[model samples]
Target: MSFTNKIKKKGPVDIVKPADEVFDNVYPTRISNISYESVIESQKAVKEFEDKDRDILIKNLKSAYEEVFIKIIEGCMLSDYIDTIYNNLPEKIKEDFDESKCISQLLNSVNIYLVSSKMGGDKTSDEREIPSDTVESIVLSKKELHDNIANKKFEEANKRGKLNNAVRLGCYIRDTKRYFASEGFIQAKASSIHSFEDVSEHCSIFLWVDNIYDISKKNDNPSFEALFTFVLLHELMHLMMDVFDETKFGINGAGNLKDLGQLYGYFREESLANALALYLCDATRNDALVYSILDYFVEGQTTPYQTGLLYIEKDLLKKAVTNWMKCKKGKYLTKQLAKEWLLEVTTESPRQSELTRIEDAIATLVP
Candidate 1:
């Protein structure tokens, strides 16, 4: 009955190899040639298909839709159900529920959710260990004051959780500066090595928070809700590509789970990750946050590689947007059924947002 099981598509193994060296979110990692050129060439071939191959595109489209749809839902903070996210629209944002605007709002809101760390890292909820920084918000009302101050602690203690001091402190300071969502660290490995499944058959995320925190602190301009949200969605996209690559890659092929098929180009994974995040943002019509995240990558970066990846990401996102905008079913995939699935999951059983994250923790602690 779970949408995850229904939608998770392993597809086929890709024969394409990655380049020997590829940038993984600015850091270069070694990979074989099962990579960018291979992926693009295969795609170009399929895209150039004659009318007879149009059916192939349709099947690919359905597969891609389901894959990304699962990713979006998984990224969402479904508490019992995805109850009313974006309820507290920023006062600065105009009151309009048009599709584009709503998408922006959702993107913005989720970053706020992420930065606030309100989602409670990896489901089981041990976010409270981090120190709260909502000390003196003159603006927060009594309830707002309590919620903001009370945010660091998870409402439950059933999970084995570890706190990343630096990341949590960064969020704490930022939270003190802004009365937004709380922040918490998930059970991802701290590395620059971005891989879906490591040699140990474990899924890991490498967030060099020190580096990211450095980038974060550099910007004097206060608006980065989009950038933050984009980063979170980007990580989620890795999961999508790792588990349901054919949905995005559209290459009718096969590969081993550990094969770094998606890890190609200078910033191949990152560029595509950003593309997927942007697509989900558009599909949901979370326009404001969409622009917020895009604008940062577009105009706000200083690091040479960051700037370079943004340039590359723009093109990647453009290709995805074009396909998605033209494909009505893709556009409606998540939006039309989000609320329904939310209700179903909430009523049937509270969906586990990070089963691997949870299982890993249990194994690590219990073993």
Candidate 2:
């Protein structure tokens, strides 16, 4: 009377007949079942074999099923169906298998694959927030800013320059936050520290804007972009020093030059940090400051000598400041010794070049 009673009475009806009955339940009569019938007929063509080949066939079928299951899960298909299918897998195939672990690994792989397929990955959406206290802060469209620069609107150009600096700072802050978050560190508030003393205390950033007159009077030889690149690199060098020290030693590591002079005793580490910072800035912004710093080290000539002097009188002095900022050995280096080390590394020093190359290689491995 019914299909089930008919199949039972027939003593295991033909696989093809049962398959066709199942298909009829799946498809409406209005749509032709020709394709479904072909699939069933093809399945029927798989014949019983000897014991050895039968084992091989079973293994292949299990592998195929696993592949299909993984693909379905990756597509975000029906979760309940996935569970049911997984549960129905043969005991030997499911032995020692962890469904949760398998699903997590597959999901991670899918996320990484999708992210890598995009242009810049997640970096594109990480927009920075500009602080309200920044002078003359105004958001401008990228196209309009480019047009202003092209038309030589000097006033607008300067304003755009300030905004660009703010954006750059914001990006750095965002990156720092990500770095801390990845390391399981709680994020502190984002605010400016007005003094070096204050900066050494809290996890903070200080933005130093050179006097406008000082910047404006310079002959248009060095582009504003170039100036911004240099100053930012210099400050970032200090920031990296702080970050490394904080991560390695912790917050209590900060003190006056005399208090924690031991850390700078290793001149090689300080030089490496400075060089690495420049390399990172160049890789990210294509900044000329990278070359300028390299040239200062290699040729002993500063591109913008005035800015260099204003920031630090000499390479020796700059090295001293770096040592003061980062040295942990608790031993003080005399001003003369700092200058000697700085000159030794910057002039025809193969060691400095090797350090720079190492930094370049490390940058490629990060992000």
Candidate 3:
């Protein structure tokens, strides 16, 4: 069965929403009108609930997994799979690919933590319910702070009040920090964004257990296992470029893909990373059907996640990642040259046979 058909048969019917609905729900509108004092109290109440729920979720995860989630981590290592993928690299660059070194970097370079999410962008039906009142208060407080600066009214900054603006600002900072450690914590499935900075010593990846646990309950447990494995590999790919690729050419680094995308609008690093992870999963499992279901799950995500499937469909993933590794310096100029090379080698005129080949390519991956 095809990936889509399999998902339709076994996956949740609501898992894949129509594109318009996806966009609308992904960027939901939130408004708040609660007072600052009320916001503080609501935040406290929310935090208490969140802390209790997080503890319970963590306990359940550990208890369910026999007190260790190491299997999932071990499964993602894929040493032989990495070797196979790099074996196809050109002879000159093949020498630079060290499986042991890469694995070491993966293990030593960053700390991984499984934690609960703050539920900012949560859409799962089984998600732990944060009180609506508390949520509204948090949103309104943030909005009020934003409007004060945006409108240049500085209503909160007025010196006429008995309580000084400095005091109010400090309160705002404290409350927000208590409610959310960082905005990223609220939305990311797994994050390596901090691992990009050269000076950052405390690089970490947080796998949001709240979302994962809820999603796992909705589907069979193995599906959750595969989903977790894919997410970790994706983040690890980013970490490899950030910490292991000594050339300092981490795709998302300052002058690499991140800057390239911002300056010239060439943004395929996320897609590349996603494609690389998908390949690793397929290689590690050698089960085309399992990987296909994973692919369908990714399709339900936002555009960046879905774009990588194009590379797989076009049979360009192997070539694309190999070219990426070949160009040691991930600068715009360097990538421009690589892009030209890719186009030159893969370019072809419209032909019916080529169309048939492309369709077959996609089918083979999913079959």
Candidate 4:
């Protein structure tokens, strides 16, 4: 039987794993052999897609989305599957896990778009450009600027020093922007609620084909399907928890209102998204694919993402997800809350050693 058939029949609890077999059946040697260079060369060759070609590509992706991800979410909502998470959650938060909200309605609301790359990495619009004329005119004869400044006749030295400062400042600004662009912002992103104001009323998820391939090449080359599904799950969670009121969080992750106007995107929110995604993978029994995907998120990623997975691994997943869904604007699982909950759990449970490690982990994050 096909994998989808297997999934529908067994639900998440009994779904099959050894992801390679299922992926091979569907994609058939299409993804495993892909390399960073190969993806780059193929994209470079295409230049731009004609209207008809773009439509066909999107059509195919939507079909695959229905066949794969839709079923994956469906299976998670099935009786034995969701019960694993729902049953463990506190009574107050149980309402969010009800059949109505857990349905595919939220899944279908997000629109997907394909792009080659997002622009921040290439250049910063605000970056200052060095003056070409000034650079060309400068001729530094002396080894040191201070030495030239000592000589009363060294007017040229002064010009060279100013030019050198401008060039250095320009380079420094350019490099800093590039680093912040790549690190602070997600390469693959889902449109925030604000996007609805200018774009269509519906939210959109952008799949940067170039960035996807590049990340895959960096990680241990998990199947493209597996990675895409994980990314979609991450983005989807963001959409679900999205709120217009930043006042709900009151303070930033750092305990200040410096970024009060912005929606909270700190450890609690990110980890909840990741922990919930990891929970789905576990409930679905997709161990083979899930472990690699987990590593993909945990390894070489920023603090919040890594810490998010750590929360899941430490067995706070069900509660963490529950709090994010039910509490005040999904901001209840703050670092302070996590520490308090961990202390409670550690005191009541026999797994003192394991809980200690989690406590140590949470200590590193801001309260």
lDDT per residue, candidate 1, 1-367, as tens digits? 2212322342111222321122111111111211233232233222343565434433433333333334355344222111112232233332334323333222221111112222223221111122332222122222332232234221221011222232321221111121111111121122211122111122222222223333444762212334444554565444333321111221112332111111111123334455565666655566665665566553542111131233233433443322222221111122212222212222323233332232233223221
Off by over 4 Å in 3: 1-101, 119-202, 219-222, 244-260, 263-266, 286-296, 313-318, 325-330, 334-367
- Judged by lDDT against the true structure, how good is candidate 3? 0.35
TM-score of 4: 0.46
TM-score, each model?
Answer: 0.27, 0.26, 0.41, 0.46
Instruction: Return the top candidate by TM-score.
Output: 4
lDDT of each: 0.29, 0.30, 0.35, 0.37
* Residue lDDT tens for model 3, 1-367: 3222422432122232322243212211101111122222222212333666545443443332321123323444445335533443335433444544434323333433333344333432322122111111111232342343344333332211222111000001111122111121222122222221221122334345445545655764434445555665565555443322222232222332332222111124455667776766665554642554464466554333444555654345644444443322332224343223222222322233443344343333321
Considering TM-score, where higher is better, how would the candidates rank from best to worst?
4, 3, 1, 2
**lDDT for each residue of candidate 4 in 169-203, tens digit (9 for 90 to 100):** 01111111221111223221332233121111233
Model 2 compared with the native: what TM-score?
Answer: 0.26
Candidate 2: residue 26 lDDT (0-100)? 16
lDDT of residue 227 for candidate 4: 62
Flag the better candidate by lDDT, 1 or 3: 3
Clashes of each: 29, 8, 0, 0
What candidate 2 gets wrong by more than 4 Å, as runs, is: 1-201, 244-274, 285-343, 346-367
lDDT by residue (tens digit), candidate 2, 219-307: 43233334333433343343433332332211122332221122112233334434433444444443353454444332322211211
Cα-based lDDT at residue 364, candidate 3: 38
